[model samples]
Target: MSGKSGASEISLKQSLRKIEYPSSAKDALNKIVDLICGRITSIKNMDLALDLMAEFVFLEIDRRGHKRGFPLTPLIELQLIELLYEYFNNMSNESARNTVFLSIFSGTTAIMRLGVLTKLVSVAIAIPSATILSSASAWMQQLGNTSQNSCKLAEGLIQDYFYFYNPNTSSINLVPSISPQFTANFLTAVTENYFNFTKRECIFPPKVLMESVTTWVSENPGLCIAAQQKQAVLPPGAIAMEATTPIAGLLRWTVLAPINKQDSQVYGDLHLALLNSIIEIPKVTPPKAIYAQHLTGPINPILSYVNDLRNKQELKLDQILNEDNLQLALDRYAQAIQVIYSVNAVYGHVDDLFHQLKLLPFNKLMSIVISTYKKNKVIIL
Candidate 1:
C-alpha cells in the first residue's frame, strides 16, 4: 500500500476504536444500525458517527457477498449485522456524541484534503469489503472544504453516488445517496465553527454552492467518471450561457403573457420593470425552478413591508429596515439575491468562486441606487 493509503487505513481503524463496544450493548447498537442503514426509519433519525460506521460495515458485507459470490450465510450475516447495530446504538448514547461528531467531521475533512477518497473508492470496488468506507467517503467528500478541489470532489462524488460513476476508472456504478444541501450543511457548519475568531468569512453554506453544482451538472449532462477522466472544463462564456438562460426565459414569458387586464394593479408595472432588468442579461441561467421559489419567496414579505411603508411613507431603506424597516429588509434580501445572480456570471463554472464572491467588491451601482432610495425614501410613488 502507498504511504497515504496506509495512513488512511490507520485513521479509519482509529476512528472505529474510539467507540466502546460492550457485549451487552449489542441490542441497542443493532437498533440504531437498522434505523440508520436498514430502512427501519423512513422519517426521523440522527446522523451519528457510529451510524455512519455501521452503514459502512453492513454495506461492505453486502457488497462482498453480492458481487464476489462469497457465501455470506443469511442467518449468520443477518445476526452479525443486528448485533453490530445494537453495539453502535449504545455507543451513540455514551456522551460520546460530542467527541464523535467533531472527530468524524474533522477526520473526513483531513481525508479529503489529502485526496484519500479516490483510493478508498478503488478499494471499495475491488474488495467490496470496503463499501462502508467507500460510501462514507462519498458523504465525506461532500463535507470537505469549499475550495476548487472540494467542489469538484463533491460534485463528482454526488453525481457518482446518484448516477454511480467510477471516478478513477471512467465507468458507471449505480448507487443512491443524500441530497446536496444536507451534504453542504455538514461541511459548512463544521467549517464555520473552525473559523470562529478568524477575520476570514465563513465557508459553509456558500450562497452559490448548490446552484453552481446543479447547474454545471445539468448543462453538461454526462456521467461523473467521464468528465473526471477527460479533465473536461468549460469556458466561462459557456457557463454564462447556462446561468442566465432560464431567467431569460422567465422574463420573456412575463413580457409576452400580457398585463393582467383584470387585476392590473396587484402586480402592476413595478414587477414588469424588475423582470425587464433581469431579462436584459440574456444568457443568465435562472436558478433551478425549485430553488428559484426560495429566492423569490422573500418577495411575499414585501406585502407587509409595503403596507408599513405606505403608513409611514418612509423610503429611507437603511433607516427603515434598521428600525423595523420591513420594506428595506425585503429589498436588502432581494439585493442579496441580485448579487448572487450577478456573481453567477463569473462562478457559473469556475470552482473557487465560492470564496471569490464572498469577497466581491465594487458595489458602485447598488450603492448609487441605495443612496438615492434612502435620500428620497422612494416608495414607488
Candidate 2:
C-alpha cells in the first residue's frame, strides 16, 4: 500500500493560488491555522483535527502563490504543531495520536513535515521510478534561483527536519545537514521549477512521523490512548475474513524463513491435500479468501508439523517429503493459484505469448517498458 515509484521528472510547482484541501475545512475561509488552533476542544479532538488541519495548510499554501515571495512558513507550521502539543497534554478524551493521525499527504510534505500519509499519497498517485533524491543537487541549485521570499521561507522550514529526523540517513548522504538557508534554496528551486513531477516522480520525505507510543503510554500516567485499552477489535458475531493470499506476518521471521528446495517438497505435499479438498467440492468454488480459512484451520497444523521439522532439521522430513509428499503439495498449490488467479483478466498478443513473456515482463511487473512502433526506413527503396 505504501510502495514507491522507480523514476520521475520534476516540474514547476502549481501556480494555482488556493489549495483544495480534501473535504473537511478546519477554519473559516479567511482563517489561518494560528487563529483556531488555540480553541481546540482536547487532544483527542486535536488528533481528529489533523484531517481538517491538512485542508487549512493546503489552502494557505495555495493562497501563498499570489504573494511576492516565499513565506519561509516555518513559524506557521511550528505554531500549528505547538498548538497540537498543548491539545494532546490537556485532552480528557481517549483518541490515540499514533492510531488516529499520521499527518497530511503522508510524505508529500516530507520536503517539510511529511508523516505516514506521505507514503499513502505517494502510493495513491504512484508513477514508477519516482524519487525526490535522484536529481537533488541540480534541484538544490534551482531552489537558489527561485528568488522568492515566501518560497525561501518554506524551504527553510522544510529542510530543518530533513537534516535531523531523516531515517534515510542509514547509509548514503543525499541531504548534507542542510541549513535553513540551504532548505530555502531547495524550496525556491521546487516552486520556481513548479515541481515538474512526472508520474514517476514522487516526493519522499526522510522520516515516518511516529511517536514512541510505548513512551506515550507510560508517560500519560492515568489511562491508555485508545479507549483506555477497553476497546475490542471485533464486536459480537464478527469473524475475521479469510485471507486469500500469502501475507508476510512478521518481517524478521519471514526473512529468516525462506522457502528453499527441501522445504518445497513438504510445501508441495500440503498444497495437494488442499487442492484435493477443493476439487471434491461442488460446482461453483468459493472465493479464494473464503477458501483460505480452510487452509488455516484444517491444513495449518499439518504444515506446522513440517515447519518444525524444517526448523529443527529433523531427519524424518527427508523420509516423508521425498516420494509421496512432493506430488501432493504441488497439486494443492497449483490448484489454488489456478482458481484464484483465473478470476483476474489477462490480455496480450496471441501469436507469441511465451516468446513475448520471455522477452518482456509486463509493466505491472517491470520498471522499463518497450513496445514496437512502425517507422519508415531510408534504405534504398
Candidate 3:
C-alpha cells in the first residue's frame, strides 16, 4: 500500500506539472481526468487534488469562450460522467463525497456558465446518488463563506438533480438512503434559495421545483414528520412566516399545476404534510401578537381569493369534486389559514369552513385537516 501510495503521489505531482493556468479547455479537461484516475490511496489527497483541478478548470473555462475554449464534446462529457460515477459509487467517506460533489458541481457550473446547454443533461443524469446529494446538501448549508463560483455550482447541481429525476417512477426508487438531518438540511437550503433567487431573478422553473420537492417529500417521511413537530411549537409571527411561506408556496404550486397521476399522488402527500405543519404552530402569546398583527397586512388579499373560490359552484359542499381540484382548494384554504395564524389573528369563521369541507365526500383529504384542527383546539394551555 505504501509503495502504491508513493507511486500515485508521484504520478499526481507529474500530472499537476502538466496543467498550466489559463490552459486550453481540452488540455485542462484531459489533465483533470488523469489526476482523478491516478491511484491515490488517501481520499484526502485525492480530494485536494480534485479540488485544485476543478478550480483550475473553472478558471480556464471562464477565461475562454465555451465554444472556443472548453468545447464539451460527447467524449469529454462521458469521461467526466464516468469519473463522477466511479467516485460517488466507491467512496462512502463524507469528506471524499463532499470533495467530489464540489468538484463535479464546479465542472457542471462551468458548462452552465458558458451556456453549454446540451452537456448539462449528461452531467445531471450521471450524478444522482444518495451520498452526492446528501453531501452536497450539507456543503451548501455551510457555504456562508464560500466563493460565488462555489455557490453557483452548488445551486446548479441541485437544480440538475431535480430536473433529471422524476419522483414517481422506478428511477426514483434508486435514490440512495439519506439521513433525516440530510433531508432537513437539503429542504431548508432549497427553500431558502428558492425565495432568494425569486426575489432577484425569475422564479425557478416551477415544474423542476415541483418534481424535486415531490421526490424529497416522498423519500423523507420521517424528516417531514419531525419538521411538522418542530413547526408546531413556533409562536405564530414573522419568523414563522419566513419558514412557512416557501413551504406553502411549494404546496400551492404543486396542487395547482397540471401533473400526471403519480406526481399528483406525491404532491397530495406533500400537501398533507404542509397542512399538518401549518396547523402545528402554537397559538400566539403576548408581545408576539403585536408583531404578528403587523404581518397580517397581506392576509386580506389571500382571504379574498379563498372566499371567491369557496363560492364556486364546483366547490359546493354537496358537490363531488375532482381529486386535483379538491387538493388545490385545500391547499389554498391552508395557505389563508397559515397567513392568518402568522398574524396571530383569530380566524373565527374557520370552523364554518371546516364544517363545509367535512360535508364534502372526500374523506381522505378532509379527515386530516379536521383532525389537525380538533387536536389544536383540545390543547389549550
Candidate 4:
C-alpha cells in the first residue's frame, strides 16, 4: 500500500508538471487522460493512480479558470465517456475493475467538490445528443453486483448528478435552464441504474448502508430536500420509486435489526442525532418551479425508519450514557450534527441542534456535547 501511494504521488507530480495555466482545457484534458491511461498499465495500484489523476485534472481546471472554456462539445464529452467505458470493459481483475470504477467516481467527486461539475453539466446539455448520459447509465449497469464497493460507486454517481443538477445551490444558475421533465427523466434513469446493483446480496455489515445513506444525505442536501418535493408528473413506469423504498428498507433492517445491543445503541444514537440535526436546520423557500421537482423518495422513508428506531424500547439512551462510552457517543453525535451544519452553511442558513443535547441524562455527556458544539461552532463560523 505504501509503495503504491509513493508511486501515485510521483505520477501525480509528473503529470501536473505537464499542465500549464491559461491553456485550453481541451488540450489539458487530453494530456491528463493520457497520463491516467499510461499509469493504469504500469502501476500496481491503479485506484490510487486514477484518483490522483482525477484530482490533478480538477485542480488544474480550477487554477486555469477553464469553466468558460471547458470543452463541452459533444465530441469531447463523448470521447471522455467512451474512454471510461473502454477502461471498464478492458479490466480483467477485481483490482483493475475497482480501480477504474473508483477513479472515475473520485474524478467526478473532485469536480463536484470544487463546484465545477455543473460546468460539465452545462456543456453536456448544450449538445443535442444524450450519448454521455446514456453511456454513464450503461457503465453503472455493468458494475455487476451490490456490495460495499459497488455502493460507493453508486453513491459517487448519485453525488455527481445531485450536486451539479440541484437547484438550491448557485451552481444551477451556471447552465441553461433544463425542464423539470428532463430532470425527472435523468434522475429516474440514474436511480434505476443505481438500484440495479443495490439489489444484490451485500457482503458488508448493514451499518455500511446506513452510513452511506447518512453521508449521501449530508453531502447532497439539495438533492435530499428536492426528493421530498412532489413530482406531479413522472413518465409511466419510472424508477424514481426505487430511491425511497429500497433505502427505507435498508435503514429499517439495519436499525431495527441490529446485530447486538452495543451495535444497536451506537447506531440508534447516531440515527437520533442525525434526525435531530436535520430537523434543526432552518428550511428555505423552495427553488423555482423548473428546479423544484426532485427524486428524493428515500428521504422520507429514511426519516421514518429513524423515528421508528427512536420509539423502540431497545434504544436505551442511558445505557450508552455511562462514563466509558460517553465520549465516543458524544463524538458520533457531534459528527452527525456537523453534517447538518455543513449543509446549512452551503445553502445560506444557520441553525444548530445543541438543544437536542438535553436528551442525555449524564452531566458529563452534556458537558462533552457542549464542548463539541463550541468546537464545531468555531469551525462553522
TM-score of each: 0.24, 0.23, 0.44, 0.27
lDDT for each residue of candidate 2 in 1-381, tens digit (9 for 90 to 100): 112211110111221113332212323211323222334434543443343344344333332334223432555444444443333333332222211222332223434443222222122112211122211212223222233332343344334333444534321122222222222233223332221222255232222211121122222221111111122122123232211111111111111112222233323332333334233323333322222222222133235445665677664644545433333333333344343223321122322322232232112211111121111112323
Stretches of candidate 1 off by over 4 Å are 1-91, 94-98, 104-109, 112-156, 162-181, 186-368, 372-381
lDDT of each: 0.33, 0.28, 0.43, 0.38
Off by over 4 Å in 2: 1-75, 95-248, 259-381
Q: What is the lDDT of residue 325 in candidate 3?
A: 49
- Model 4, runs deviating above 4 Å: 1-19, 22-28, 35-40, 44-56, 60-104, 107-114, 138-185, 189-381
* Span of ten consecutive residues with least summed lDDT in model 1: 223-232
* Candidate 1 residue lDDT tens string, 201-311: 522222233223333333332211111112112212212111111222222122222211111321223233433433332343542311233233223233444456547
Best by lDDT: 3
Ranked by lDDT, the better of candidates 2 and 3 is 3
Q: Please, what are the lDDT tens digits per residue for candidate 3 over residues 255-342? A: 3433212245545566666555444445544312112222222233333434555576445634434445445554555454554444
Kindly indicate the candidate among 1 and 2 with the higher TM-score: 1
Flag the better candidate by lDDT, 1 or 3.
3
